[model samples]
Target: MNRFVRWLSASALALLATIVLLPQPAAAAPIPCGHDCLGISRDAICWEKEWCAVPIEIKGTLPKEGYALPYRTADGTASAPADYTEVREGVLWLKPGGSLQLEVFVEGDSVRERGETFLIEYLDREGRVVATATVVIRDGV
Candidate 1:
């Protein structure tokens, strides 16, 4: 009886040690974007007075018919007609699982200056802002 009890205790301790030393499952990270999320292909871009295209992507599932989202540009540190040609307002029609690219004209100059920034805002049907993408204009020089 004494030997049996000792064996059982040793087995229990071994099982407890195995359970305590086992690797635990990792916690999941929170997703930054959700359904109908709008994102840009490149978060930051360099401009040298040439034509620049910003690739806009739509995340998550879309309706079978299609989706239309209104977009417009706003000045950040960069202003229109001086830093970049302004895109006042435009409509982007995206089919299911489809994406679109927007062409922008960035002004280039020989003057030395720090990087500038601008914003492209996506709007809903009611003209409410949904998502925004920041465009960084780095000096090409």
Candidate 2:
């Protein structure tokens, strides 16, 4: 019985040592901002005479199946037809690790005024706004 007990203790110690000393698989690097994060590259842009194309950056893990979402612009301090050309509704097709740009037409004039803002909104299939990016239009002149 004493011999058996000693053998059992030794086996247990060997197993513990193996578990403690053995290398483990390295942990995966954490993704920045978490999964399903999408955003615009710039928070603001200077209004050009003709138009400005804003780049939308897609980050984090994207859906493998891909999807199409609705996007549109909403007036803030800036009004359409005078400040910008309104995008009533547009379709945005997205894939894993992909990016796209949005073009906004700006009406230019010699008149001096304060800065204006507008919203670029991303919506779901039901037309509910999901994500939004505010763009500040700086006066070019």
Candidate 3:
């Protein structure tokens, strides 16, 4: 009787160990950016004249509450308010699942110089940079 009881206990322990050691399926990954993601359509824009405008198309899955597109210009050859005008505002908003065309205006003039470069960057809600674009002012007549 004692021997039978010991065998039953050992069998139960072995069964429990096997179940615990079995592999399990992994959990699904978390959705990025609150179920929506954002990106830019292009990486570069060239200006042919003074007061030239470059359109940066906003692409990707827009959030339900809408998103505010933020950007700032960094001078390469184009200096703000000297070679280019200050951006009217920094934040542009878009509706859910919607696309938008935002313009980057470059102040142009008849200055035969090397191509002036400037940078435009888009920021996420947390002020993190999501994408970047370069604006080049062609040097010509």
Candidate 4:
């Protein structure tokens, strides 16, 4: 009886360990832009410019909880694990001409920063797309 109890306990521990080591969903590597993609999505988001920083207000629903989002710039670079503020009353709501002012301060003394948000629009019903736009910021230009 004692031996059976120990074996059951050990089995439970092993199963728990295996579950903890399991992998989470991984976003597939971005595919190259086929024609001309002006927006960011599951594939990739690209931009271009010189010396800039801008705060974007992401309006709309996100993927499941804890979805790893990627932020890619125009110069073959990306920055993310972005500042994702929670949704509350007046939190993340944007009027037609309303805006949120985020900052992007690049390092280096004389390095020019040219960054742009190629596509900044919310996906619509049926998860297709409705309106799309780009936000460009040229910091210290």
- By lDDT, the best candidate is 1
Expressed as tens digits, the lDDT of each residue in 34-132 for candidate 1 is: 365444334448585977766665556555666666778899999997998888778766666555666678898888899999877777677777666
Query: Over all chains combined, what TM-score does candidate 3 have?
Result: 0.57
lDDT of all predictions, in order shown? 0.70, 0.70, 0.61, 0.35
| After superposition, candidate 4 runs with Cα above 4 Å error | 1-110
Give the RMSD in angstroms, all C-alphas superposed, for model 4.
15.5
What lDDT score goes with residue 66 in model 1? Answer: 60
* Candidate 2 stretches greater than 4 Å from native: 1-42, 61-66, 95-98
**Comparing 1 and 3 by lDDT, which wins?**
1
lDDT of 3 by residue, 21-47 (tens): 999844322212335554443444566
TM-score of 1: 0.62
Clashes of 1: 0
What TM-score would every model get versus the actual structure? 0.62, 0.61, 0.57, 0.25
Instruction: Write one digit per residue (lDDT tens) for candidate 2, span 62-132.
Output: 56765566778899998886788889999766666665566778777777889888887777667877666
- Candidate 1: where are CA atoms >4 Å away? 1-42, 97-99
Full ranking by TM-score: 1, 2, 3, 4
